[model samples]
Target: MREDAESLDIRDVTANWVNAAVLDAQIKERIKSLADLAHTPLFFGRLDYLHDVGAEQAEGAEGESFYIGRRHVHDAQGDPMVIDWRAPVSQPFYQASRKNPLDVRLRRRFGYTSGELTAYEDERLSDPAEAADGEHTSRLLQAEIERPRVGPMRDIVATIQPEQDEIVRSELGGTVCVQGGPGTGKTAVGLHRVAYLLYAHRERLARTGTLVIGPNASFLHYIEQVLPALGELEVKQATVESLVTSDAVPVRGTDPAPTAVVKGDARMAEVLRRALRSHVSPPAEPLMVVRGSRRWRVPAYELEEMVRELLDRDIRYGAARDALPQRIAHAVLVRMEQAGEAPDDRVQDAVARNPAVKAAVKAVWPPVDPAKLVLRLLSDARFLAEHAEGLLTADEQQAVLWAKPPRSVKSAAWSAADAVLIDEANDLVSRTHSLGHVVLDEAQDLSPMQYRAVGRRCSTGSATVLGDLAQGTTPWATTSWEQALLHLGKPEALVEELTAGFRVPREVIAYASRLLPSIAPGLAEVRSVRESPGSLSVREVTTDTGTLAGPVGAADGGTGAHGGTTADAAAAAAGDAAVLDACRQALKHEGSTGLIAADARVPALAAALGAAGMPYLSPGEETTAESRLTLVPASLAKGLEYDYVVLDEPSAIVAGEPDERTGLRRLYVALTRAVSGLAVLHTTPLPAALAGAPTA
Candidate 1:
């Protein structure tokens, strides 16, 4: 190829790319395409098949070898050097097992350091003696999983487990919901599935596009690189907040928990529907279209009949409104024909746009802006009562109504809950464009209304829903996967569980599992494949030195004002300093360290860390090369991990939550984020769920 390019005439297009000559747009595009192949691995692994099953397949022959990688590559002669992992014949690399080898005899995995292959491992799958365990947990796989911390998340194409591969390669037609424990690779599987779908149906997907929705901006930023690394740079990624209101308007305030819960219910969908349709009023007199010197009139009864027909068809508000004018004009045409006049389609169109006809259409079928409609619903008591009479109780309705309504939708302070409501109203007014596929991560934390908003984007498509039931830590968190699936408009989706964790050690997972029965009783206990015996530790902090005594809480667990108990309250009142020491100690050993505490304790911990000359990053920001310590709020720590985690005051973390169950779930998430070890420093007694367990 180099020789050919060198020998080409200076006027040739190939020479243009090399000489930076002006050329057609197609020539420029080819130049850009060639330039994209400079970096990244060309191939990562190879598969040797037993028979000629893929002989007729493109770039495949009898007993031939295939190199698998993120994307396809070939020589100048068109002979393939690396096959895209999404190709049909590359299935055995991920799905092959002892029970079903898929005619694959040997598999080789290559280790790359800075784009150069440093080592390789070979597994002989055809030999029954060597494949009995059916375990793909090779040393290289472990090394990839435990690779040192770097930047944003990367693709796990080389070490996908058989079970994860099944989910990743599931057919693109149906929805798949995965219940994965911490370190179960659910997020990676979800991203890879999107890449697979785009490859299998590129033309169809390119037309509609795909989306990946995470819980927060930080979580999205952490995974923003996965799809692009897989050669899918066009895939869209956003959080629910950014996808809904940030794209439409700004959200600047917050609502109370009870009000948010009410607004996020699926029942709000019905109320919004009634409120929007209520704007359509009956025509006052009639529709009259004056053309040239003649005038045509359609009676009030006929206009009413036309409106009724459009409304009953269940069409979108804008579509029905636009069609009303044409219907009226069509009626005028019918009258003209009966009166012995010849009128054409152009004549009807002119009549439809007439001033009288447009005024009548405006009166009978008015247009609505979703933001203004939502503001009106929340501000006007009478209007809200009339529309929400049957759907919401009086108390619930009063709770959602704004105390001092803003004068305009633009000036109004919209909360996240209000943003979701606006999205619902927008969908009712006009149809939201559907996508080809959507991957929703940490889905258990979303409200039903949020799910509905996501559902509308993929109504005609499918989804890969991923979350851990026990990690749900919200006031309106879903109680079951079935309920979540139903709300996402994919109730028939297949539900799969992944319990074998590879990141969190066995001791750490078992220590965290004690809270499962109290929080999510229906979920099975998770088991970890990495068994580090001394991974878990608990230290009791004392306040005698007037130092590190964490926050105390009520013993009876009552959280609404009166408090639970005297000692517990006293313990919570006195803040702890031991948490800072633990953070300092954990930073001495390894990769990345997180100082996790309750949302309220964040200020104190940050001050302490800063005073001690430790620079820390929030969970929302990416970890840079200079910083090794991060101060993570419990709320933002759901989908993050670190090498060593320093947890401060379990009781205070629990007290900050609205309820005990949600608090326990948050604690569970915090406890399992460590890849190496965890330290629990508490001034007060541990929660009942973890009180009886061994300390270290």
Candidate 2:
């Protein structure tokens, strides 16, 4: 496949330089897509149909047999050697069952070790004997699901479950919201859906574009390579903040939880709309345009009527402003025609550019700078009060108001919420560019305004919203997927919940689900398929060691303070030691190990790890064999998984949040990150909800 793509001679195929350049780029992309990756098999599964399936069949074949892979591969004679997973014929590979064979006689799953096929399992879907017995579980599928995760996230095309394949293959015209719990492959499903959509509608999506929105830079970095690995390189990825941030309003500061919540409320959208419309004023003077040896006059009342008509139309702010000049020019043209003079569109356009007409348009409809408008709305109390009179209460208005407004937009300390506000105002002035499709991951953490910002990007297209409601840790976390979809402009979107676990072991997920009743009462608990005993361990440190002999403050560039009592210092040292021991034990395993701790406890843990001669990487850093340990802060642990995890002080993780429920959600996220095993160490008592959970 690679040789065929590379051998294509496009140098003399085009007649012009532009065509040649475009062809060259396309050829290069095709060559890249065909490049063979080391250890990644060309195909992972095969399907044997009951009879000859299609018009194009293998030479001398009785029943059609097709190999399923990530990308399509063909021989020199244009005969398919491997079929793309997104192909319609390959649907039965994932969805075929004993009860419903779908004409698939045999479904074979391949297991690979270091990219070489080591084992294969077959299920006779069409066999009546097997159908009468019961369902058949493939050992290869379970092994693939329980495989130790090492570095960044990988594509799940080969391991996609029937439920996940349905979501991935959904039509591109409608939006989908997946309320999947931890380890349900929601992230992978969202990504594979993009690959599938691009396959089914390549030319359309290529022209319209696609994007994947993650929660933060770390999560985006972790999953950055999944698409490329699946032969998709055109899709873009970004965070909500990055999508909204512009040069005029870069996020340089943060808002208090209360303030950010108010700024991110859905009401802020209406407030921004009202504030922006306030810039338009009724024209009090008449407009006079002097043409060649002729004077065209428009009455003030007539001009007022034009402005009123434009406002009533409720088009985009900039669109209406652009049309206002033409309206005035048309009025002048009417007078010209009434005077027995002939006029054309060119003449009307020329008149619209007239200084008198331009000045009149400016007076009635001035240009609005989105950033400056937002600045004024946040800075000027009277202006904000006028726009937010009924939308925001006085207390809510004060909460969002800047204590010290900067003199200029560039100089202002814009928060993330403020950037979203500017984005809204920008859309009010002009329409945001729409993409063909968008995948929003970790969506529960997004604010309403943030959802609006994302929805604007795909207002004319569609979206795949993926998140776990139980993992919402933000103060403005979405209360329901229904409300979230409404904010996203996709109120009619289909919502699906996935409760089956595939990554975290059964014991670990069961332990983590203890907090579900406290954090998300209405959500169902995840039913893990893999039952691995001794996968979850909770250790409470009771023994105290002496204080650290070295200065612990050096870890965070703080002065060493040894002012605590002997017992306090000893207990702190002992807790640190226990966490270190847990990490060491986790590192003894074969895959990546993560030491997750609360934001407040990171410095001390870092000092402990350094003193113990343990080298570790921060979140988002690529994990290597020699350095497979990553010290993840509780806040950044979402959307990240490890083979083994050593979680420190669940109580501290809970306390890091603004409220108890959100805190418990954060703790739930931290607890569920383990793929192979989990060892939780805590010196303090567990939360009431987790107190009754099984411990080691």
- The models' CA-based lDDT, in order, is 0.82, 0.88
Regions of model 1 farther than 4 Å from truth: 1-41, 53-63, 113-116, 131-136, 246-248, 543-577
Task: Identify the leading candidate in terms of lDDT.
Answer: 2
Q: Tens digit of lDDT per residue, candidate 2, span 1-696?
A: 678767878765888889989998999998887777777898999999998776333322234788889887778787788888888888999999998999999999999998988999989899999899889668999888877777788889889999999999999999999999999999999999999999899999999999999999999999998898889999999999999998767899999999999999999999998888888999898888999898988999999999899889989999999999999999888889999989999999999999989888888999999999999999999999999998999999999888988999999999999999999998999999999999999999999999999999999999999999999999999979999999999999999989888898999998998998999997999999878899999977775353333222222332223356665566667777778888888888888999988887788788888899999999888545558899998999999999999988787787778899999999999999999999988766788989887888
The count of backbone overlaps in candidate 2 is 0
lDDT of 1 by residue, 587-666 (tens): 78757888888887777666666766878887756547767788888889988888889998788788889999999999
Give the Cα error of residue 100 in candidate 2, in Å.
0.9
lDDT of 1 at 663: 96
TM-scores of the candidates in the order shown: 0.90, 0.96
What TM-score does model 2 achieve against the real structure?
Answer: 0.96
Model 2 weakest lDDT span, ten residues long:
551-560
